[model samples]
Target: MKLNVEQRKIVELEPQGHLAVKGVAGSGKTSVAIRRVSFLKEHYCFEPDDRILLVTYNKTLLNFIHYQFNQLSEEETYDSFLSEHKTDVTITTIDKLMYRSFKARMTRLGLQLKTMTNRRQLLKVMNHALYDMKDNYKDVTILSPKFQNFLLDEIHWLKACDIQDLNVYQEIDRIGRATGSKGMPQKLHKNSETREAIFALKEHYDRLMLKEQWVDFPTINLMALREVEEHPPEGYTHIIIDESQDLTKVQLMYITHVQTDKPHQSIMFVADNTQSIYHLSWLGKGRAYTTIGFDMSGRARTLSKNYRTTTEISKAAYGLIEHDEAILSNVDFVKPALIDRHGHAPIYRFFKDHSSHLVFLKQEIESLIGEYQYKDICIVAKESRFLEDIEQYLLSEKNSSPSTQSSKTRF
Candidate 1:
């Protein structure tokens, strides 16, 4: 497919330091990223062994990016482009990158090589820490179960943003949990007393994690940031990030540490703030959630033309997002003109009971079975329990052969 005018500019432009691509959904940000890499390959005289790193949030997205690169290379007639640079190019989730860094420094740091075996184990540790904070500190307020969860969540958010100091954590507002994101209102940590207590609990939790040698997700990122600061990775000329809006500050620290500081080297961040699901890690309000401090002065580019979904669907999605005042403040809110394609309008159904909903869902699946493959169809649910219910219904009632490789119903 031919590149859109905006995407073409993004591919052709040679940014001096960093380039931030703020693209709406289906605005071809991914395509632009792939082409930008290809453009460098063709024009930049990059060495055969020069590193080009691409980072994202998840394995699924990484796989999709690799597929897009393959398709783009083929279309551009850069035959064997990926194969030639296979060793030089790195496309992976931030977690894997952090793990690699952690592994490299594990011996020197004396950090235990371990993975979180269960989420419940961490939760148990957190609860114990909370209990200790309440016992040790008379000033620390005893918290309810709901408030305890919020405190733990806030601590994780602090760590992601590289805020380990109690003073700094207490001073911050929202702790990167956007008001637009899910959960109850901003009722927790209203007073300095509450924040102080939470900070104490956080310190306790940190101590417990260290004592147990338990490695959690936030610890991985914290360790990765430290490793990058102490021993920067070599050979990376360019760094391209997808879903950049979801990235935490410490993650950006790692990316900055690894990439070369040469004048010609390019670093690109492509994301749509409206699709940002990591507001909790942002630790601030409005645009601060999406803008990394490192990329504050980067050249900003916005891609508004959407090439996916119908006009009706696009309007509906945009309308829903606009209704959230906090989210709208951070986004460009450009109402995209959808590709001209006729399709059936969406339908909504409400059932009085779970049984009725399951019955309706099963009937709908049966109707589409002949026309579509099971793997091609997707069923999304707001809650995981709903998905679990669907899974149980499908297995028990339909005797469906569950695909081990793919999640038939993914959240």
Candidate 2:
């Protein structure tokens, strides 16, 4: 694929210090990021120990980026760039990077880090903490089963944003949770009583983890951030982060510390704020660039052209969130301009009951099976339970062998 004008500008940007690219879906943000890696290698002179790093959010994206690099290395157009600028680039997910840092820190402290791979074990610890909280906290709302998930989210958000002080958390506005006329219940962070209870629960949870020498995902990030802050890494000349909107504040801090202390080192973050589903408030508050300590005065760019979805699809997707007051209040919404292509407008069908919906889904799958391969057809649901219901119905009633590989099943 050829680079568009905006993408070319990003790829060839000079002095690439703290560059942030905000582009809609299919705006070639990832492509521009990958090309910039090659551009840095080709144009910049590096010491023998200098390193380049590419950080992604998940394994799927990490694999896709590796595939892109492989294709670039073999392509005739990029052969010269690949051969001449042969600098080592490290590609990894944020989770793996944090885990490595956490492990190294633990080793240095002579502590054995117990990895909790089982969800049930973590849940058991949480339940125990809640049980203990019932006696210590005055708010009975925290004891409700429905409040568990919300409490967990608040805890994770606090840690992700590096809000260790309860006073600071209470003073800050909760941006991600739904408020006002949205009809959704107000979040617990809004209520002083519940906020106290949540903080107590977090403390209890932490004590339990400390007692057991166990570390969960969020704790790993917090530990890693502290480790990196005290002992910044070395030899990194350039760092590129894709899907940066999904990253939390602590993770971003870890990225900053992992880079070398060179005066001319560069870091680039490519993100679409509209696609941020991780619920980080800094991006919604229009302070994401500054929050990461980056002065994006002349380094920021936005890609307006969307080449992925058709006009109809783009409009439909935008329509879903266009009037969402919560979303509008937080994100600087940029409406994408689609290429001159037309497709069928998204369809919405309503069924009276679950059985009817399954029947319709079965017929649709049977119809699509003839035209497309199994892997090409995906069925998405708002929750995993819905997908499980669909899978069970298909297997027991329809006698079909549908694959439920992930939340978004492909069969």
Best by lDDT: 2
The C-alpha TM-scores of every prediction are 0.86, 0.89
Residue range 339-367, candidate 1, lDDT tens digits:
67656677768999999999888778777
The best candidate by TM-score is: 2
Clashing pairs in 1: 175-283, 176-282, 176-283, 176-284
**Each model's backbone clash number:** 4, 0
TM-score of model number 1: 0.86
**Candidate 2 wrong stretches, greater than 4 Å:** 73-87, 179-185, 189-191, 280-287, 329-331, 400-411
Per-residue CA lDDT of model 2 for 1-411, tens digit only, reads 468777897788775467878788888899888888877766764676667888998999988876676676335344454465456667789999888889878987898878775766777777888887777665455565455656666677887888887787777777757553323346645547667777777888888988988877788888888888887756478999998878888888888888876666789888887887665535644554776787777677888777988999988988898897655664445678878988999998999998899989877877776577667778899778899998878766443434322225433
Give the least accurate 10-residue stretch of model 1, judged by summed lDDT. Answer: 402-411
Error of 1 at 30 (Å): 0.8
RMSD of 1: 4.1
